[model samples]
Target chain A: MTPEILSPAFGLVFDPYVLWVVAGSALFGLFVGAIPGLSATMATALLVPATFFMPPIPAIASMVTATAMAIFAGDIPSCLLRMPGTPASAAYTDEAYALTKKGQGELSLGAGLVFSVIGGLFGTFILILCAPLLAEFALRFSSFEYFWLTLLGLSCAVFIASGDKLKGVISLLIGLLVATVGLDNPAGHPRFTFGLPELMGGAELIPIMVGMFAVSEVMRSSISVAAPLETAQTAIGNVFRGMWGLLKKYPLQTLRGSVLGTLVGALPGAGADIAAWMSYAMSKKFSKEPEKFGTGHIEGIVESGAANNSALAGAWIPAMVFGIPGDSITAIVIGVLYMKNLNPGPTLFVNNAASVYAVFLLFILANLLMLPFGWAAIKSFKQVLRLPRKALLPCILVFCILGAFAINNSVVGIAMMLAFGILAWLMEENGIPVAPAILGMVLGTLLEEHFITSMIKSDGNPLAFFDRPIAGTLAATMIALIVIPTLARLLVRKRPA
Target chain B: MKIGDTVLGALFALLGAIVLWHVRTFPVIPGQKFGAALFPGVIAAGLVVCGILLSVRGLRQADGGGRTIAFDEWARDPVVVVRFLSVPAGLLFYILTSNFLGFHIAASVAMLGWLLVFGVRLLPAVALAICFPALMHLAFYKLLRVPLPWGLLEKVVFPS
Candidate 1:
């Protein structure tokens, strides 16, 4: 808030080392995020070891640049091949792919890039203004509040389901079951290790994620391998061509997505993926032409693309302020912050005020860098899609394998990818939704942790969950989210169509 | 294969039952009212309810006598199945052979085999098969400091 603090932070962030790191990480994120099997989370995981060597400002800048670029780059594959590069992209992959198939590939790619920038910048502005206040609010939250918050985030799963609510619930339960497999469970006993030492650590998320989204895509592609590869547009020319026009027409959707994404991102457990899903669902729910959502509409893409990137910045609000991670990426960032001796919390703002400003400056710089970097990335996507499916699919397979193995430096991760890949393929082929299952996996552990800890704190008194004011409000909202929708549906059915 | 909701529901129910039964045996943490099984138990029960709902839907559709089992578009062709199975085979091949043949050789073979199986020409497949894994090896092993098992490459690339 002071010029003295801002002056030193400006010096720290503008250093040559930090700029280079941001540039390098932006490219790294683009490559990893554009690849079908790789994701933004994986980008950060791979960057962690390298970040350990850098100073705090450059270390955090690299992450900020990479994740922002990665989330946007994810849309490139989604638009081009119908394969989302990350789970966040999965929220709008169908919508983007639909546009590509409609011969509006350039528009699809542009919406993703432009809205991502708008959303990212918007989230940063909000973070700059609200982080200190939000952190103060978050600090008062106990396990009971967190339990409700996580539950509210988990409620997004039902909204995320594309079809068959029953199937969605089944898929979510499956994911929750997978989360219970490790020894880190509240009881301290591994529930489903099957006596294997590797299993005792529970499942690594990257493999499960890659398996469900990427490997399953591979399997799906393999079945149709003999079919001739057809593209909606053979060449992508000037992906930024129609972007300005689209932006002019849909300014409000962009704002709505950014706002929703930031709020969701500030929630402890929800991340960009949830933000995108929620935004997409919200876009559809409020759209005048909801029926056109899956048929290549750019409206949802504009919204969710904005969402996922903005959510990336929104996540930092909690991570920088309270040390409580807003998502998995920030969870890693929190560790990096601690390692750099910039321990998060309100004290850090006072004790290391300059460094906090350094982080903020890095965020602004990273979002600004996305313009050129994302432009180059869109151009590159066209070139990559030109490869024959036969050649390209194998290349993707190699990336998937390498990415899975690199995560834990173990073959067990690869095995998990294989097993879940087939399982996901079967589920998809059968009418079950895979996205909810993934959300369940991501939130399941947090849900359990919060629930158990709150129970322990409340000494198993069910009423104690509602003892706190925030907890009470959250519980009421969660109930309303479920009940109001059902009641409305019943009322609608009672009336004539 | 294209399966109906009935079978899918049964499978879900079966999975739920197995989870519920298995979690019952989990050691309850001493002096804690809720144990490790609490969350999983809740999930399993939810799965059971979903399975029941799915079964009811399936039964109603079946009673209409208009439903029929269907093969997916890909399943109608034997070659497609070959292409589909080749992916898993290629993955399993890499897992088994990566250490013995080395990451480079095994990955190249897997890539080459997958391309050929998927009907890529021999020359292009061979070229990509050899080139791709080397690039990956450099990035992961040399740059990232990940110790990718070299196997046969160890003797040549890192000889004593």
Candidate 2:
């Protein structure tokens, strides 16, 4: 990043129109994220249609700003209602809510707000430093290397991230199957279009994502519509009061959380939720007062709140450089990037250097803006709780409808949303993790394309996959990731027997 | 609804089998052994193996009293069931009607049904049903310039 790149990037992000978008999306993110059922992913999903009309910078800006705000705002509902507004907040919901019950809601909410900003900025700094370096390194990668890397990312999602390995693979296969629907493959043959013209373009990612993340959530929320929403604390006073003291007191925990959150977020198949869970566990393990964890303690809240928020930026690293999403949010973002002609790979860095830097600036600006916007959201949260889920849910559905329709200007998108909505709902009910399926859908075509190109280059010799040094190392790592774990499990089971 | 792993596994296996059989007919790329069928074929093979393993594990487990399917606790409540069903039904209703009724009418009617079904008061539901689509129109249509179908409203709003 030169001064020239930085200057133009600043111009792109600091434009009046772009700033307006960032501010509007900040509020939109807070509202959706503060609501118990609406997630940060849904915030991104619903914003996609609006972004369709935007240029690359503002479009990227809108998603970046919204998701960052949404991740922080999710802590609001976690503190007040014991219901996590997003999956990422679920890790520390109990701790935050316990504080609310103990009449220390201000402390928990304040720590969440402050630490989230720190963690987000920390992740963004790391992203700024590492992404360009990685992209430069990746510029030398061939089709063979890419084939292995994409496979490695997907394998990580299934083997390392998901709980039920068998079910995760099944979900991933379903996504891969879905990806083979259109004629966009190397062979130019449609696999499962069922003779529809719309199927020729392959399954649209936006509607399918809206269905999986948003519609499925609405379906789940609909069943509980009769259940009234009541906040544990009616009045929150001065959330910023004790935040500085807590930060000074636990600076090591703060740093550790931010580092771990970034690493976890950078990993494939895992996002903020996993990062929060892992960091919260790590915090407990390292804490002197581990017993105070679930009992109104603000320590876990501080660490994991930062973890989840920072994970948002961490997930963008692989997404920007490799076109491999770190989580479901970037899975959607990759599609948007492709749509905007800012294809997410090493070439994006070389060709769109200004845009890449613009994205970095947006991340920094978004995190800094979180303080005031999040403060306002916390103050006005009681009013948000009063909005009936019954009315609000239908309104969200209407938005989902418009969002889905705006993607293709066709009812087919809506139909796809409805179908996948039901499919995702069923998949979740069946204990199948939906994230791998999403990763599969996003990477499936790319994986196939690279594999075919590699095969053609090597003239059908499978051993050529491991001929390149980088590809060989990645292949070894992927194999060990799968084999070593299963082997250990088998050995342990045999010993027990 | 909760389905047994055995049943789910079988469904996946059946799906994989169907895909595997179907893809065999896809023509190969000239002078190359691999074709479009290769990727899907590999995935199908994986699905089959995973499905069988899942079924074996499910059968070994003694949960659910050996039942293949079970409704959730909330499934017992007719009202909750209706609420859950209404979501998909409403979205489907919009998909089928959006072109003819237009986005406004289709979306409003669907939202109205959802709000009412979810037990909001009649007046507020009616008001929201009417207002929300208009709000979306301004955002999606006016601001974003999405070519939202007018359906029946096309005649009245932009009569030639």
For every prediction, compared with the true complex, DockQ reads 0.65, 0.86
Model 2 residue B35 CA deviation in Å: 0.8
Looking at model 2, residue A44 earns an lDDT score of 96
- By DockQ, who's the top model here? 2
Sort candidate 1 into its docking category. medium
TM-score of chain A of each: 0.73, 0.98
Query: Which residue pairs of candidate 1 clash?
Result: none
The ten-residue window of minimal lDDT in model 2 chain A covers A184-193
User: Which lDDT tens digits does candidate 2 get at residues A268-306?
Assistant: 889999999999999999999999999989888889988
In terms of docking quality, model 2 is high
Where model 1 places Cα greater than 4 Å from the true spot, the runs are: A1-21, A24-116, A159-163, A223-363, A377-382, A495-497, B62-70, B152-160
Candidate 1 per-residue lDDT, tens place, A406-457, comes to: 7677777778888988988888778777656765676677778888888877
Shift in Å, residue A487, candidate 1 = 2.4
Q: After superposition, how far is residue A159 of candidate 1 from its true place, in Å?
A: 4.1
**CA error at residue A424 for candidate 1, angstroms:** 2.8
What is candidate 1's local distance difference test score? 0.81
